[model samples]
Target: MQDILIVDGYNVIGAWTELKKLQKNDFELARDFLINKLSEYQAVTGWRVILIFDAYLISGKETKTKKSKIEVIYTKKSEKADQKIEGLIKKLQNVKTRIHVATSDMAEQWAVFSQGALRKPSRELIEEIGQIEKEIKRSTANTHRSSSMTKIQLDDATREKLEQMRRGF
Candidate 1:
């Protein structure tokens, strides 16, 4: 079965420490950070990620775009992120897909749970992200180690001696 993850953007940003701190200085930065994290999560988990942001107060039409291979949606004016999420839960429901909604909102959790989608609280998602980061670090370290082992590290004197030997000196 294919997995789909729906993220409540503001709720997650408000829940995560780093994102919250970034939001204090620049909201856009926080949003971009969250999107990049989600993109990474999607890449690692092989899940389809949909990140939804509320634009009710900004007075903009609904917008959908792809960032870093993840789908990002901004709610239309007067539309709440919860409402958009609920609608998506309804539309994306199917036997072949298992949907997971990530947010800290208790009410939204209940709503999505009733729709047969699993609820992952913000902190839980953060923990998973941390684990993913650790795995990535471990993988990178292994790759670096393997690549480094392949290179010959001879000092200049040793290299010169080898060259002389090869030339039948």
Candidate 2:
């Protein structure tokens, strides 16, 4: 069973400095940025990521969509993201499946722990994502270096000449 990561979208946005700054100018853009980051995190960690945004104050039905292989959920009217996240933890928790909830809410963390799911603070999640991104950069650099090296194809005679030169022949 794959690991699951449930993110409380607004909470994370409030906790993350970059997102908070972006949110001040454009809320939608901040949300989109968060989703994009989570998508990358999901790809790197191979975890099923579900990001929940609260629409409790907005009169509308709940919406769920898939973006870059990650799930984005807007909670229904009168339903908070925390409630939805808890519900998901309850539904997905099992011996073989490891569920993680990311939020800065202490109450939410306790609730998640009670449901047998792991809790990741928003700051911690940010750090984890940063580490993953660094790893990706390093891996990409290594791949580029290797591909460049392989791109230079030498003929058998050229290879033999270089080998003899190296041997001082």
**TM-score per candidate, chains pooled:** 0.89, 0.86
Query: 1-169, model 2: which lDDT tens digit per residue?
Result: 7799999999999999999999999989999998888988988889999999999657989999998887999999889999999899878888889999999999999999988999999999999988988999999999999988887788999999999999999
Q: Please list the residue runs of candidate 2 whose C-alpha ends up more than 4 Å from where it truly belongs after superposition.
A: 151-169
33-89: candidate 1 lDDT, tens digit per residue: 988888889989999999999995688689999999999999998899999999998
lDDT of each: 0.94, 0.92
Judged by lDDT, which candidate is best? 1
Where is model 1 poorest over a 10-residue stretch in terms of lDDT?
Answer: 53-62
Candidate 1 residue pairs in clash (backbone atoms < 3 Å)? none
Best by TM-score: 1
Q: Which regions in candidate 1 have their CA more than 4 angstroms from the true location?
A: 152-169
